[model samples]
Target: MKKLLIALLTAASLSACTTTESFVKGADVGWLPQMEASGYQFRNRDGKRQDALRILKDYGINTIRLRTWVNPSQDKGSGHNSRDETVAMAVRAQRMGMRIMIDFHYSDSWADPEKQVKPAAWRGHDFAQLQKDVYDYTYDVMRALQSAGVAPEWVQVGNETRTGMIYPEGHTDNWPQLAKLINQGYAAVKAVSPSSKVVLHLDRGNDNQWFRTWFDNAKANGAKWDVIGMSYYPYWLPGRPDYTASIDDLGRNLNDMAARYGSEVMVVEVGGEDDRPQNTYDMLVAVQAKVRAVPGGKGLGVIYWEPQGARSWSHYALSAWGADGRPTKAMDAFLRQP
Candidate 1:
């Protein structure tokens, strides 16, 4: 009877773990505060005025992703993801019962596959100082968030670092150096908030070879990360392949990543052309299913990039909000049941 009771208790504990690790339905709203400051108003499907974050919550978004830039500009569309702003936003989202994922761009502007320009202040620093800069900056941000009563569930060391981050010094070609820099960020994150998972992000989620090569190099160089974050934007691919053509590849890659590294995987960024709400909705649904299907539940979640940044406001074509101030039908994809 004691053994039976122990087994039952173990099962209940497993069930509780599963409940706590629910699939994340999230949005990267780094541009939200700027948009709201510029006088943009968000409305629900019924066209009633509403707080933008609340509107997102009602659309089934339970997680919020915000980017942080090192010395950002104040330009309307090109700036304002400073540390203070990020902490404030995280607090607001947390108050609304949303989980937070913090993306570190490590640049004054955007940081991605094509451009990872070093921040102006860090440009002149030698390799050793650069590593120190990465660690100090990451530590400062994490500490600030902690002091604000917000603990990020995931913290990206760098954004879309397909080639590597912090430019020539930290580029993938110099994997050894890049690994050191990455480790600095990872160490800093753990120092401030040990439970927050550190993510090593890359673009092209469907390309398994690319991911394998990059991660293999990272592993050999002793870089550390808890999650493999991917950006899967079919519309942004060179030929603009349809999501249907590559989604299966995404699924296979997600499973392979989980099995290969024994780490959680997440479609940290995804989007579709704003004009085709139906198509975008379908793609989002499929993407979530693929993530959910990862064996042992290693798949963490999907987060649409700046979904509330309407085309009219940001001149971006992938947002899920309409020019009419209402969320596009694509936002409803998150509302669908797994």
Candidate 2:
């Protein structure tokens, strides 16, 4: 009887030790709630105007990525991507049992490679003050989400920081400054939620050389993060005509980066031409295949950037929506079982 009990207990222990799947099939629907607020609706194949989250769930999207702006109210409160707004979206996604990734732009508006405008509030502050602000703000945001019982699975320190974030102060040319700011944000994230994975995001996934230089400098400068997030938008790159080749290289680069860094990699933002939905589908299939093929499965997942932007308030192109407010065939790529 004692031997039998020991075997049963050992089996129970094994079952309890089973690890959850880490692959992330995600979507950056940051504009979703705002779209809904603007009276836009989403529909599935059946033509019923269902909630966007339900549609995404049906498409096999297990994660949601939301972006937050420091002070969007500067534009007459047109800032649906504000802190409070993001928290509300997180609550809704949590109710649906979907994982969450929060992106901090650190500016009043967009903060991509070309434009990293300092928020009005922080424009006059020196570098020291900016670092402290980033730390405090990141900590406060995480605390707020924790207070609401919404623990984000991933938190990005900045968005598409190809050349670094927050302009001249934190630009890539100044790796030390950039690394300092990122470390501050990373420390804040850990302090608030030790389980959440922090991501350092950048654009142009096909550029492996760029990543090597950036990561090498970042590491040498003492920057740390759990994951490397990259954005791949074929239409926006200079070699738009060679997008197919670029897509293929994107997969290879992701694998190389993941293996080299000993860290997980995710295609945090991806979009394709709206006119060629089937082509978009094929691209997603190719990209996802490459990501999943990473050695030891370090490739985490792919995320569509604003796939529901059918006549969105921002008039952004490269969305996966049809004229009928339904997802194009391209979105079917995410339906594959993980």
Candidate 3:
């Protein structure tokens, strides 16, 4: 009887683990609230007006990614991802039964490989104070979400920090400082929401060597994170190579990052040109396939960056929405079986 009970318990443990792992189909809709506020209506393929989030959910997006900026400008084209806005959006998405991923840009505006400008409030702070700022800001945001009954499942410490964040202060040239800043954000996230997985993101998902070099340095400098987040944008890649030319590399990189670091990996951002819906659809399908193929279920998800930010309003070409306020065929890629 004891032996049989032990076997059953072991099986239950394995089953629980399996059940906890889910392949995330997510979209970064940081611009959504602004879009809606600007009277941008979203419609399904059938042309009936609908809530943007509902349209996304109907297309199989189970998760919503929101980016929060520090003291963001109130500009029409480039604002409105503030803490209050993020919390409200998360609450709305949570109420809709969608998971949330909070991306901390740690800047007043966009933070990416090309730029990681520090918020104006943190401008003159020395390294030590900057670290404290990162922690306090992260903790405050997490606490706000918690107070609003929204707990993000994944919290990105920084967005696309290939050269590092916070400009000259946290640049890759000072890995030690950057690592400390990352740890501060990670610690704050865990302090407020213990179950939230911290993500460290970088651009160039298909470049295995770049990932290796960046992560190796991060590891050496004691940067802690739960997931390796990557941005894969073939549309922006130099010479604009087709997805076929580099998808295998992305797959290999995903597998390698997982095996090498014992951490889950996610394509946190990916998008193709909006004008080429079929090509974008095929690219998204292939990207999801690559992520799902990662060994040991280490590929957590793929997120479309600002998919609903229609080209008409945002002038960005990578969105999956058409000028007519309907999702293009590219959005259907999420419905494809893995």
Q: What is the C-alpha lDDT profile of model 1 across 256-291, one tens digit per residue?
A: 999999999999999998999999999999999999
Candidate lDDT values, in order: 0.95, 0.86, 0.93
Worst-scoring 10-residue span by lDDT in model 1: 14-23
> How well does candidate 1 score on lDDT at residue 210?
98
Estimated TM-score per prediction? 0.94, 0.91, 0.94
lDDT of 3: 0.93
lDDT of 2 at 11: 96
- Candidates ranked by TM-score: 1, 3, 2
Model 1 steric clash pairs: none
> What is the TM-score of candidate 3?
0.94
lDDT of 2 by residue, 1-338 (tens): 99999999999999876633467888888778767776886889688999988998788888999999887863422466888889989999989878999999988888888888777888888999999989998998899899899989899999888888988899988999999999999999999899999999889998899988888898899999999989988888885854687977887788888878898999999988877888888888888887888888788899998888764445666888877878889889987754
